[model samples]
Target chain A: MSGVTGQGPRTDLLAAVEQVRALAAKHAEETDEAARFPVAVLDELRTTGLLGLLVPAEYGGLGGGLDELLDITMELGRADMSVAMIFSMHCQQVAGVVHHAGPRLAGELLPLVAAGRMYLASVTTEAGKGGHLLTATAGLTAEDDGLDIDRFAPIVTGGEYADGFLITMRSPEARSAGDVSLVYAHRDQLTITPSGDWNPLGMRASHSTALRLTGRIPEHQVVGEHGQFRTVVLNTFGPLAHLGWAASWLGTASGALSRVLRLLRSPDGRKGANLDSELLMTRLSRSRQRLETVHALMRHTAEVVTRVRAEGDDLSRPRYQMLINSLKITASEECHRAVEDLIDAVGLRHGYLKGSPTGLERALRDLRSAALNYSNDRLHLADGKLALLDAEVRFA
Target chain B: MDARFTELLTPYLPYLGDRELTADTPLREYGLDSMQAIELMLSVEDTYGVELPDEQLTEETFSTAGKLWDALSGQLGGQGSDTAPAADAV
Candidate 1:
């Protein structure tokens, strides 16, 4: 509860985020054009100790929660969505460890993470599973004192660069596909072979390439109880992942709108005849309206998650699940729409140019991935099913 | 077993076509996922007009038709006691 809304002064964390934002802005274009990871920005985050932003203070981290995550990711999204996304995904893994790991694992791992010595990546998506996170095709092989797993994930964001991975596999004593376990393995314990290219429409710097991984995971490293990875998914990964992604997308839209506003106020824009056009003003206003709504929803959802965690409420309950799902769906769709409207308002000559002062072109391309990253269509189906169960529809 | 309970669960268990649902039948085998389990819980609550306590909302309670019915009947008080095993049988 203490760090839920970032209660105390977090000037140090915010200041470090500002520094990361500057670094992201500097290398964003080059990173995108080269379709590579934002090395300089991530290096800056490591050196600044911002990598441990979510780790508990007792473990040497800032002990920030979802609120702080939203603030940092939003700022990063404004500068470079890829950087924001990478950071967001990393935080998701850290949250899993924080919330679900046993005492021994927590004692051993959190300190390393808090010390900014480890960067975690997620390996939930499998070769033929699409984006499914609940079930696993790969089963863990029981070793004398641990588990061995060979997993082939079609997309592992920043896989090669991560110091460790949170991998999901079928439980050793599995009854069905849904019986899954989340295992943590350091890079040294795994033979990770990068496969496929990472060239994408946008978010190019995310470097989300396919990876073939085979690793040995000690028993203590298996998160939560055996076959309770679903609990971890529902409680931590699902909510935080959606919240972080939505925040980044919201930031992208907001950054675009700000740039457009700056352009409209410039001398060139003041001299233009369209500046007086009511249509342009209306479009800008509409974009702002959408972005504002998304902003409000993102903050509200983050607060709910923080409160639920503090109060020991079931996050998997129908109402909470629906709220979290709606946040992702609405933020992705609305933020994309806002970016589109801003682009329309800026017009082709400036908006269409890659090097335009408005910077709307890059923002447009980046925001396009917001909907497709996890595929809004899949979420809609899941939410539709959840809706059948959430009979009351309470909003309090 | 209530006919309405089976009727309500049939749609969610597409894998259980042309098969009668027995009390001991494992719901997961017939494709009753976590979401469907919740839907089933709501449908059972609606049909029985009984509000299941938060403590009764658990994976074990919904693991099978019999267990689910046992929990529902417990909420319903004396009725269906013949069908449900003793509350502390496990």
Candidate 2:
């Protein structure tokens, strides 16, 4: 909430990485280019226990927080955003589902996620919902036992991979679209048909396709309380998204920077007057500052989540909403700048190549869609400013 | 003054104490997982009131008690009165 402090979640950053790197090497470009999923790599990640990186150890997970999540996500993103996006939602589902569902259900689900027995995903996108449920016709009516739901959530990450879907629907209890409810739809219960190919310019393998929900969501499947979904899933999950996605931008930026430095100092690459030189440093310096602050925002956001975990009732709602929104905005802007700067500095040598620099291009496209997620609207940007000025935005 | 951290350093394989650490005494190599490192830094920062930069995670910075004392002293800027550090005017 307000004044986020603490070291957030702890994780064995290197220990978690040993296997990811191995599978990542063979995570071929052909699969990504063809808009095919990295099935083997995904399977490998699940087995590696990294699929549950966000789940706390108490819930049979590694108990990692934002920092470790970023470290792993960045490295994977540099290698493949397709993997990063897939993993991002996985962690996102862990963070949100666990947070909203409370410890008991979380304890049950997190262990399953950590053990890689079952993966989790967010069913929040919609062709009608502006990819963010901003404007949507999806509604949830009260069922005999639980909340029965029907919605078109487009662009779901881990959609094709996860065994369960955390879909968002407007509850009759809440009285409005913003008053959302989270229902955990098991893959067995709903129809998750892919709408089309995930043939984006970048992040070709994210494969965030459309899922058409067409059946009963039992009471046990409801992740959060009737009206708690919007603030929790939409507003709160923003920071988690920022932490995971921002790391992707950071990885690409750092990777590109390292590549330039290595080649520029070498005998063959030294003569360039292009981006491998003095003027690039100025842009890089500013970009670095922006990135560093974004990192701080990410840390701050995680601190809030951790605090909320420890002192559940003591959490501040409005502050959490604002900074969470801020982090999302900062993530979109800074990541865009990071990728743009990298392309400017490197001039797309391996990037635009027919078969080379697959990872870099994937990052570029996946990041382009960043501003589209979770209310990255100009109206919200204006609302974020007004939110700060008003100093009190009520949580539904 | 906290000898616990100093003692913790000894069991971490071994170290060749030059300006930086060697394979035997490599501080960077001493299983300083990012998670543990953050906790370690926080403990040190709260106990000693010095913020460690990501840049300062070099082998040289954590070579030995003596070199660590120098870096810590520089960062402390004389706020800490742990005077074993007082003799080293670094």
Candidate 3:
């Protein structure tokens, strides 16, 4: 379900996006399999230099800022949300390890990323039969080169293909009261047992299976301070990734709207053409308004995150926190909404009659993957409290 | 800066954007959001190995270039003090 990317000549970034679309379009079907990974697509990413998305220019990366990654991610999401998710996970890895682990560690790790010699997946979330922890809640031991992770993390994309898993560890190191540590484990040491299947409604190709992190973490691979890992997660990657993914969601939903509109304007080749012609314009108008609202929210959040990164104190401001929560909730909900409307606009005839259009089923699968893991009710309540609070509303 | 802080400021300046900040200007006037403020504090704490209380974030104490130097001088004054870095305000 890929669409044409950029024709704009202003930045090489547009070209980069076109490349992602080409790769995702090529693997749309194969990656849609519940158990299969887009290894080929990732190989293409390695060559495309998108893996070093967060790496600094001095380290031979594209050196694009946070916004660049967001734009590119949107294009990827449009092609296939599963691939976009993988890109997001990998970019988060790049931001965490390269930015915090000191110059020496970054010097060593940056080269591997720039060359596409290795791929990294996030093994932070875990799976439990009764209940699952939101993040890694286990511990690891200091080994010769890495931390020996004991439990497996669920929701890992690129697990089967990555050279390492950016696993979070827990310990009572007196350096900080919190019990979280950050470490990387080389791929060779662990086993990649499938959790179950990624038969999710959207992002079906995500392959976000559980990863058994029963392995060793060589000293060389242990990047970032285990002591201050939480700080890095909350303060650094938290807002940045939040805005980036939201922007991507906006772009994908926009693309879905565009695709549906294109179909509507086309000649009535189908016998049930009256179904689309009647209500298509009305729904299209609604989608446009929704998309615009998402766009405005993104603009607000991006500015706030930029200020929060450069300035500080703004995070506590009622405006910024509310915008942050609102962005997450709105983009996620609307993206899924756009997909539902788009599919219906295409009508049951497309699925039940016309087969499919450009992996439309895959698009639906990818969209729902993003829709989960969201609790708008809690978000809105917290946002309301923050808005009404007397004191500044900051976690710190 | 004691010759060391210069290195830190050099790398951090780009993060500050185009607004040319001076020691006298109120940091709030520019775009000193709390995340950046906290990030700056963390960087300072990591580099100096001195933890400051969270209250110092208010009161607009260290954010000003002038206040920052004053705070540093007070914290690092004379003989090495062992108490936690004093927090002024939020």
- Give the alpha-carbon lDDT of every model: 0.82, 0.61, 0.61
Candidate 3: misplaced stretches above 4 Å? A1-10, A33-35, A128-135, A143-146, A172-178, A189-195, A218-223, A269-278, A312-319, A344-346, A351-354, A358-361, A374-396, B1-90
Ranking by DockQ: 1, 3, 2
Task: List, residue by residue over A1-396, the lDDT tens digit for candidate 3.
Answer: 121223221266667668777888778766665456777778878887878767788888777666666667777777766677778768878888766776776777788887787688776665552222223456666665546668766667667778877776664232221345677766777765666655655565667666676866555555565544555655555565566667667666766666555555567534445644658656666767777887777766766676677765535444555677778788888776766766666667552232355344555555554545445665676566545432444532
Off by over 4 Å in 1: A1-9, B1-31, B35-70, B78-90
Question: CAPRI band of model 1?
Answer: incorrect
TM-score, per-candidate, Cα-based: 0.88, 0.69, 0.72
Cα-based RMSD of candidate 3: 10.8
- Provide the lDDT at A358 for model 2: 30
- Pairwise TM-score winner, candidates 1 and 3: 1
Chain A TM-score per candidate? 0.96, 0.83, 0.84
lDDT of each residue in B9-59, candidate 1, tens digit only: 778776677888878866765668877777678777777787877555655
RMSD of each: 4.3, 19.4, 10.8
Question: Using lDDT as the measure, which candidate wins?
Answer: 1
For model 3, what is the alpha-carbon lDDT of residue A55? Answer: 79
TM-score of predicted structure 3: 0.72
Least accurate 10 contiguous residues by lDDT in model 2 chain A: A1-10
TM-score leader: 1
